[model samples]
Target chain A: MKYVLIILALLTVLTVGFVGLRGQTSRQPPVMVFNDLVDQPKYKNQGESAFFADGRQMRLPPAGAVAWGRTPDKPDPGNLIDDADYYGLKVIPLPVDAALLQRGQRVFNTYCAVCHGGFGTGNGVATNYGMSAPANYHTDRLRQVTDGYLYQVITEGKGLMGAYGPSIKPPDRWAAVAYVRALQRAGNAKIDDVPQNLRGELEKQP
Target chain B: MHDRRLVTEGIRVSRIFPKNSRQIAAALGLGVVLFGGLITAGVTYYFTPKYTRVGYTPYQPVPYSHRIHAGQLGLDCTYCHTNVFESPHANLPSPNVCMNCHDPAKGNIKGDSPLLAPIRDAFKTGRPVDWVKVHKVPDFAYFNHQIHVNRGVSCVSCHGRVDQMVEVRHEQPLSMSWCLDCHRNPEPNLRPNELVTKLDWDSAKDWKVSPLTQNTDSQEAFARKMVKVSALHPPTNCTTCHR
Candidate 1:
């Protein structure tokens, strides 16, 4: 009983000592020392003086006054409607413009014809070189796609074809998409009658 | 025999009573003191402001006022802190930028202007002014000024009413949890893309022009305007804040 009493007394004393020490540490204010005026040691002659001898001085620019380069007000192509159909996210129909088709045809011969062939039936020079066969643009899937979606696939590049974004600017890329759609339509055309100008050439071939 | 027995019993009773009472009294006294000390210590820890080695309130070379530029003049916060909406650092303006209008000196100095001394010194010495930072977050915390600014988080949300303040105080606690609160449930008042940099829109009397307009002065209007609309959205992942 006597030993238990002594042990308890010792524990109590230790607890009190710890509490007192903690209190003392908490009360002490944080020290802040302002450095006296001296030349910035890093650059001797060119250093900014730490303190000004004359208190009267010119006004500095306000805080947060950094000038920024102006961003141009051009439309963000990322938000283009063409992206809707490409991801199978949305379908926005665009009018079939002859000018767009002509532009598209030119772009296709330059870019797509190297892989998909001029006729677009997957017999391009790339296929002859043992590259992966380009898809036949006349497939039902291609036909069903909205013009916007087709444009997105061409501009952004789908599957094996890397994005043409770096090589083709926006207007040219959109033209290329229109051309692909034209190729698909031409391939699916029925051979009921050839154009009047082309009939004579067909007869000579036979 | 009766007298001897009574004397012996009294001596035994007295010894037991005094020693036991003294022990009990001492134990109670010690327990009270210890519990009281612990309560006091806990309270102090809870209430006291935590200070860092690089103290929050470092003396600035200039006493520039955000209140004048952003608050009263109704200038866009991004007008000066150009990269605040794009870069990590809301970079300090160069002395040349200040000299654009201020070389002529517009405002009258009351006694000694805190801002003027640094500018004059920089002009005389051909040295860049070294302004001290206020509202500094820990280095480990990656806070993007662009993300917040673009997402429609008002300058006032983090910096408090800086325009109202003469000498910018570290108004917000800027604790991790304080940031998380806004991230978790962003205020609804966030504006649309085009109007992100315009603060004058807040005081505009037009609401019919767009749904994004700030017509009403209610807290709800402000909260609604801060709604998040971004590609990344508002990421709550640990690496978002920690790294």
Candidate 2:
């Protein structure tokens, strides 16, 4: 019994000497025990390439001599509007419906509402920093503009604004235009514009 | 071979070992087995990804705070990660996107600050900033941000309150068992598709609880309805993620 007790005490001391707990902050890379295809030898998206002079896999080639598989990018049927029509004060190609307005509201809240106020009043949270007054849709200058003109400005940004053409899809841009028009109408609505039944409720507000 | 017992009986007998020599040898053998088990348990606990992958906070080349940008500023996740709804990968924002607000001549919010030098340099020199990706599953496991975000899995579900994290940390293990835990039962982690980006969204407080829209008093019923409506069948088959 004494020998068994002594052996157990010695084993406990050795076991406690070298073990540390898990989930501690580790700056070192995790050692992979099963690295089956986890680290593949291939080019991934936006990966650096030592073979290129610029070390960028996504950069434009430096004066490459050969050109192949190039197609003339003009008047694609997928765009649903021609370049001339899009720039020539064309109407919105998509159907103007509740669904379009809802989509417009969502996209506007995500992208535009950061600078433009949620209500398009040019008083967003960004203005609290250093941004100048974003264009207020309530102003006569923006209210009088053509729908195509608004679309063009959004696609190809004007003076201070950056072009959203790359980030936002074209359909969402049209939806935002429709939503901007809705905000303008909602801003300017008078008592007569309200439904006859709901006018009493509007007047009842304190 | 002689009568050694008679010969040594007169002298004081000395034993090289104790009287309990058999007991000591048996105890030593048992100790070896127990010590081996302790080492095995310690290795299983401390050496796997469950321990190593969590709490990994690598120092980024240029530090950016998700807490200030996403939490305090209230910038939506999609504002920068624009392709999550459409593409499998949630793309990192190009430097031009950063320059929209950080340009020295333009929006000019801390534009000249030394902290923003890397962003401005990338914008001018056309080289990408080396932002270390923190939360990554192994290359073998395929994770689609589009499918998860659109199906009402909030970023907080897997990432664990990223808006609150000043520097990104690997909050979850990202092991296959961790992924399977959610894939097996995802009701508690789900919300409406509309509010997926709102990190702190709560159905009881944020959503309207009315039977008219079938957003009933019970939040579980609503989440189950969402699963049925979206037809979410998260596959547990081998090829689903490994492929």
Candidate 3:
């Protein structure tokens, strides 16, 4: 009888211990409940603020203050996009290297590819959303527009397009511009653009 | 004679209290059984997945069904939630964005329906539709939609089968441990960057060779390679989300 009582106590202890461990595994309530900022009363952009003497959340930029990383609007002498005709200045203002072009390709695919298709044909999936047909980069009309014109359009949106100035930084924007030029050049490339050996091999194909 | 009578009386008194060893054993048995039953019930109740708001389908202003749009017509998640890839907030679409397709000027596809009256009124008045936000994490826990989307996490990763949901509900617990499960090893959930918006992207059905490299490697291999090459460095430190 003594042994049976001892066994029962041991069994009870084991069961209680297991239950305690299981309870520990369950989620404990956080020390403080989550403070939902969205639901909190706050001033939105351009919204009225009683807290501030000036009734607006957005303050005007100081005079002569330029945006971060943007060069002055005045064209630099060495600037490749300055007064250059479309096909005239083939060279990129920034150093042209394999890495720069590769980086440009990535940036272009992320931002520009939605409106201008992945292959620059302007038949993006965004067309389904009732967006007006984007211009095809392969056309001679786009090919004739200078690189500066493309940069400006991207900076200050043209036609139905919204400005991407805030989202894409200046350097990345230039990279996208470089990528656009590469796409056009590739679209209009001749057989001579291929290596001499590769051209012979291509001609061999019946 | 007196001693014998006293011993017999003591035994009889003890029997009145506990009856016999059989009765005492039965009472102990009952106590053990009761203890076991309560403990089992307690563990099952506390540990059940049903506790963490699983089927909490809240009613919205407009009964916009993801089932018809995403499942039937096969509209991508990105069509409406435009900034999922670029911003932390998966922005609710303004009425003008909705008007692009369902404008009265354009063929009023479903415009006249009473269900859409609120949308029409908001569009006409330029007042925004009050969309009820689902799947909101705690304000203190920072979740960046862009980082996850860009790093190859799909919509279906956290929002299980959103395409099939008629009315979206909270599926995952969104708990700290639930998040840590993915941040620890994110290989299985990862996909190619282009397919981030594609909620139904299964690696098994349409496997392709890696275009990133010239060599012929499986898509899964490509994803694993990307995890390394991108140097994803998903921080496990507390400050990553808490701060």
Highest lDDT scorer: 2
lDDT of 1 by residue, B14-113 (tens): 9878857887888777767666776676555433323321123445677677676556544445434544655666655555434422443421123144
lDDT by residue for model 2 over A25-128, one digit each (tens)? 76666777667677676676677778876566775533433334433444243355533356556567789999999999998998888888899998888888
Docking class of 1: incorrect
Candidate 1 Cα misplacement greater than 4 A, ranges: A1-206, B1-58, B105-115, B123-126, B192-233
Write the number of the candidate with greater TM-score, choosing between 1 and 3: 3
Among all candidates shown, the one with the greatest TM-score = 2
Query: 1 or 3, which is superior by lDDT?
Result: 3
Q: Report the alpha-carbon TM-score of model 3 versus the true structure.
A: 0.59
Local accuracy of candidate 3 as per-residue lDDT tens digits, B131-159: 65556565567788999998888888888
The per-residue C-alpha lDDT of model 1 at residue B169 equals: 60
What TM-scores do the predictions have? Answer: 0.43, 0.86, 0.59
DockQ of the two-chain complex in candidate 3: 0.09
lDDT (10s digit) by residue, model 2, range B1-243: 367776675343325566777877787787777767777877788777778788888887768898988898889998899898988888888887887777887778888989888889888887788777777787878888888888888887878888887888888888899889888988887776777888877666655643333445556877788779878778888898887
Q: Candidate 2, DockQ to 2 decimals?
A: 0.48
DockQ of each: 0.02, 0.48, 0.09
Clashing pairs in 3: none
Cα miss at B77, model 3 (Å)? 6.4
Sliding window of 10 residues with minimal summed lDDT for model 2 chain B: B209-218
